[model samples]
Target: MDSIPNQQHAWVNLRRGEPAEALEYRADWPVSKNLEPGEALVKVHAAALNPAGYKLMKFLPNFVANRPLGDQVFGWVRSDHMRLTNQGALCQYAKVREDWIAYAPSNIPLDEVAGFAIVGITAHDMTVKNADLQAGQRIFVNGGSTSVGAIAIQIAKSRGVHVTASASAKNEAFVRRQGADEFVDYTTVSLPEFLWQRAEEGRKFDYIFEMAGVTDPSMYTQSDSYLSPMGFYATVGPQPKGLYLSEIWNLMKTTLFWHLPRVLGGPKAPFKLVCLDYQREDLEQLQRYISEGAVKPIVDSTYNFKDTLQAYERLMNGKIAGKVIVKVNIEDN
Candidate 1:
């Protein structure tokens, strides 16, 4: 692509602890430069909004100091000082690291492109890399109805692994359609009992992709019972905060009673609790998956660049069944 103009349109956050209503459209934020060799200045055709996008904005002020505190911020504010100022895919153009850009799948609609990168990378890292899933192995994915869950199921399926997933009753069919071999209704069924039954039937999983946070650590322990001696558990959610005595005691109980034995007696059981950092190579690999039809983007809705707040609102409502996207540049298409 050619060099972009000095100024470009972007949605900016004006203050902290406010809703999407606080975001504003700015036609003059500096069009970020392609400073590095491998970087590409993408004329962002579409961008996807993830749960983290809104949550970060709500909590950014508490995390970063001295930085402008508000909803109108955009892009990385520096590694340690990073804050969500207006960083969702709801804008006209974005200058992304070249390695972070991937070719949109021709099979998927252009509007759905934004939904793929963030959730896709998260699911890929959890299953293919963190869990070390293999063909014929069984894996359980929590939050099967989620965007990340949808992509993770497909990735595991493509690798020839059998999948058992948990979602609401309403999303059971959706989960199965995404290649889940088994579906568990989290609301109705006791997860541990269900896993125990599966184990009694001689069906044990090799990994547990714990997309849901520590709301139920016993679920992890129960799932561990059915894991092949050396299975792993990986989580992408935020850790609980404010160390209370009860919280510490609960943590000790879960660690000693549930997580310890799996770590000691069985195969090297790896449990991860960390944030995902995207790399250029991972983007390339994701592009290949898109091109080869191993994975597909799922979009729940799209908003025009001007209606960026509406996009964020829809994501916050939690009613969206797939990725929420923003069409950043209508004129270009």
Candidate 2:
């Protein structure tokens, strides 16, 4: 183990706004070295950016109305439940819950491994936990080129499930490369209409996983046309583009879809928001998948320590096909 430093660099959000406006890079942020039982300090080699992190940064001003707060480049410290109170992975070192950590697959590059946990865990929950899909079942993955979608496709395929997924035509090949059995070019057609056509052809899917955080409810509302009677629909959650009335309207409709009872003519399939719950076994399963090449970590781009802001900008642009990684310990790059 390397000698721990007293102070480390971190990207702090002093106020709420876009990444560039809200974040300030500090070289002398204090390092919290206090370790409770089951906590371990990680000398972070790299950290991956998730849209949730920034979305929270933009929306949540403070946890206690004024209390300020603050990955892995991989050793463990404390559970993710402590995340809000502890320092974030955007710094040089992170303390994570011991049970939440797992060994990185030796076959994966260190930079890519930094991103595996979050997406991997979410994919596991979506495909394995929530759906419990069996061999020969069929699944539809929205945003097939996105990180979670890609991993979900691979995980589904590993279970012998057929995967039909959607992406823009430009990412069709990328989506297919992640083991999708069939592809839908969402940009070229109305997604609901296309699925309805498949339904007409008796190609109903047993599971539908939404990774794009779509605000539109039409797909869920009309899912009876294509989803199996016993099928399930899960999502990361709806993400409104902005606070505009249009966005608000979309959310209201989505909320209704979620809460509406089947007796009220809601979609036939059940719905759920697939959130990642940390489990040591799930992390170990992901490590095994990576070790066996059943799943591959997809890194869309890498940014150096000083260029952390640029990394956030790339992530916020929302055009990338995989996880956006920041190399926290520059020497690791």
User: lDDT per model, in order?
Assistant: 0.64, 0.78
TM-score of 2: 0.90
RMSD of each: 6.8, 5.3
Candidate 1 TM-score versus the reference: 0.80
Give TM-scores for every candidate, taking all chains together and pairing residue i with residue i.
Answer: 0.80, 0.90
| Stretches of model 2 off by over 4 angstroms after superposition | 58-86
lDDT at position 55, candidate 2:
81
- lDDT at position 185, candidate 1: 95
lDDT leader: 2
Candidate 2 lDDT, 106-173, residue by residue in tens: 78677877777778888999888888889999889999999999999999998999999999999999
